[model samples]
Target: MFRALGAVLAAGLILAAAQVPATADTRAPARFSEFSVTPTSLDVDHPTATYTGRLVFTGADGTDQGVPGARVCLDKDGRCVATTETDADGRFSSPVTLSSTGAQPQLRDGEAEAFFNGDAERQSTFVGSGIALHVTQVQARITMGFDHTPSVVGDPVEVSGLLERQTPDGGWIGVVGQTVRVFVDGTRIAEGTTAADGTYRISTRVPVSDEGFWGVETPLPGRGYPYTVAFANTWQRAAHRTLVTGFNAAPEPVRKGAKLTATGRVMRVTADGSTEPATDYPVLQFSADGKKWTDLYEDHPNSQGYFSLSTPAERDGYWRVRTEDWPDLPSTSSVDYVDVGYRTAISGFNASPEPIAKGRRLTVAGTLKRDTTAWKAFSGQSVKIYFAAKGATSWTYEGTAKTSSTGHFSHTFTAAKDGTWRAIYAGSTTYVTVTGPGDYVDVR
Candidate 1:
């Protein structure tokens, strides 16, 4: 027994010496480095944003180094989720999905830790300073629309909307006492605060800008809330509305050959609540029907923002002024009107019996028309025939004829000598005057 005990003691000393090399080889310290967290601002209601981080090792020489195969863990409210190994650069990042398994379903502060297997000294025992990780709560909802569509430039356009929040019971309720801003063509034109029930309205006389789309924005304060520089988010990022109106050409029944003017104005609210001109020299337009507007090349606005374009009113049509569509503002059309009268056109005329003897009768005929029904015949129209001898410098009135229902007119006169004959239709208040080409009747 004594001999066996002496051999066992000698074997234990040899085994202890063999383990020394393995223990010292694992002495590298696991330390956290520059760990960071994002989503400094997250909505309490949605809370869908992820939290991500990094880690490095502390060498024996007290220097930062990336340690591979070391475990790192994330903690929220003191309980922890398991860590993954430090990667190529000693960096590890993952989202903090929840507080912890079996913990409360609530917002909580979070931290990070690094651990080395089989070493208690290198594992994290307390939260470190200068590290950020959190779950935040700040939420909002917004809705907007225009009260009056197709409004005039000087008319009050009412922009209204609601600011709401979700209740614990999953129902949405209004947010009261919050300020909301309204814009036209990217310019702030009005503002209002939410009422007790969460509704907001602003009836401001705005200038005509672009065609129609307006903007509405509302920012919520993060004080005493979850959002800071990191949690910077809001519901106003998507508020866009529209202000609509129509264009017109005033005063119908514009007589033929008279000048008709085109006109419109745009009024905009300044930042200080004063009104000013919204657009310059909007394009003048005309259309036979109200549906399609054509650009009128002749007229534009004067220096004082007054628009007038004189165009011959020869055909019946509609007229108005319009602006181009912009990203922030809707294209606009002003209310105006145009009713053109007729333009007279002599279709044709001729003298029959090209060669006639003296004392023989000659016949002259012609047709008259207006543009109302596109070259429709003009009945009961008076057509005057004129005669001019071969050497006569001016024509003399010969005879008159009334047009039939088909726009035909005729007259017979004695052919006393070689002469040229012509037909003319004196225009009325609605139709323009016209004359047909002369026809020669040679009398021998």
Candidate 2:
């Protein structure tokens, strides 16, 4: 009885094994029929593109195995331009190389069909099986990136996209928060993950040296190669690189009474490197008092990180230049200053407590004037007052008063019921901050 039971069990095992499906293999049994390609569609960059396509074979009782070592090809009429072989995993992949300059390949444009042939020993003509795959050109667009900028190798970076991708199966896929690999001039910079809303914020930081500018490249995974986004500028980097040369950090005390210049590279900084200089926002501004600014020259960055600005030297005062920061792109030197001449200039001066009252007002005063032969004239200029209580973001405009023809103005603010008081003395639109006594003023 035990022997009979063992025999029955062994027979049952054999039956199950026989019923098992035959994966794509060179020695698959006959009667193997039916082949389906997953994704059923493909998005290739161009004619000379290489992409992996999955082909699945289904046989009777799943016993039908895949035909490994089978050749697949694409042809126009009779000439075969590309050929691919099935892998052990039943995947057939080939570089769909074509001439972009000449005749372009299109869907249903030419007789492009996949074929599979069984081994010579097999009585059937067809190999495991062949399925038709539709090909389409991938839709790509230029997308700008924003900085939640991450520089550290493991820091999270915030990246968002403005372009959308269409899947092969007629489905619209948004690429806003798509995670992509960060690369620098063909080298892998780092990997980043996209946010839930199609924006990506990579926290991973990259190792940065004193490179002038690093390139930023992002590759859509399993889709295509990397595309550049922006460039970053650095002073320590030896060689010139791709980057948007906006405003770099300007140094103090440029030169007095001569032409002052400040220039540097600007680019996007990511775990990756800098991007090519495509867009430039060049700026060259000057300030005589270092409080009021004037733009002498301005231009955009070109493909190269070359920027030049020329301004007159200060005679007896200080002057400086400034620029705005770019998104994703780090500025080289945004500002710089210089002082020309044997200057005995008043750098800064401040006074406080407006409205001249203990409980009802707070007052403050200040002046910003160049040390010149006409310094006495500034003393006669009108001055405004601004006030605010503690924890206030903006100062309240109180009133304007003229100096006693001596560039000096004062006012006492009537406080309602003061706890803490602060004042600002406006100097030609510029204001100085000053705080009053914190002692509580008696309202009674």
TM-score of each model, paired residue for residue:
0.28, 0.26
TM-score of model number 2: 0.26
lDDT agreement of model 1 with the native:
0.61
Candidate 2: stretches off by over 4 Å: 1-243, 248-370, 373-377, 419-444
Scored by lDDT, the top model is: 1
lDDT by residue (296-377, candidate 2, tens digit) is: 6776655664665566555434333333543333233434444353222221233333323445444544432434434432
Clash count list over all predictions: 29, 96
Compute the lDDT for candidate 2: 0.44
Clash count in backbone of candidate 1: 29
lDDT of candidate 1 over 110-163, digit per residue (tens): 443333342444544222653444545445577877676624445566778877
